[model samples]
Target: MIVTSYGKPAVVILSVEESERLKELDRRVLRLDEMDDAQLHEMIAAEIPPELRYRIEDIPETP
Candidate 1:
């Protein structure tokens, strides 16, 4: 875990394996967002390897 100088919780640091897994999940989500519901459902049915997935909504949005 990363912390701020003021004794506040900041960003977290993940292990390399977990980080890579989440990165792959992020790529999948970005691609899935453009698809129709059925396609998304089919893809999900195909089973994406689940892992720790999270969104940092506090960050600025980017294309």
Candidate 2:
């Protein structure tokens, strides 16, 4: 799934092929503010082959 939040928030669910391609996106080294919880969830959900996904808020602020 592809999701982006620019205020109203956008969510796009992808097929297995697209999900595989989306896994290639690098997310470990990006700024927190660059993406919100929903976007992050979608990206990470695709990137990591997780059995279950979790939502974590309360991340520290960037300087």
Query: Which has the greatest lDDT?
Result: 1
lDDT (10s digit) by residue, model 2, range 1-63: 446797554988778887776676653457868888998897777754465545566455665
Number of backbone collisions per candidate: 0, 0
lDDT, candidate 1, residue 8? 81
| Candidate 1, 19-60: lDDT as tens digits | 999999987674656899999788778853556444687568
Clashes of 2: 0
**Worst ten-residue run, lDDT, model 2?**
47-56
Residue 6 displacement in candidate 2 (angstroms): 13
Model 1 residue 44 lDDT score: 75
Name the best candidate (by TM-score).
1
Q: What TM-score would every model get versus the actual structure?
A: 0.46, 0.23
lDDT of each: 0.76, 0.69
Off by over 4 Å in 2: 1-9, 25-63
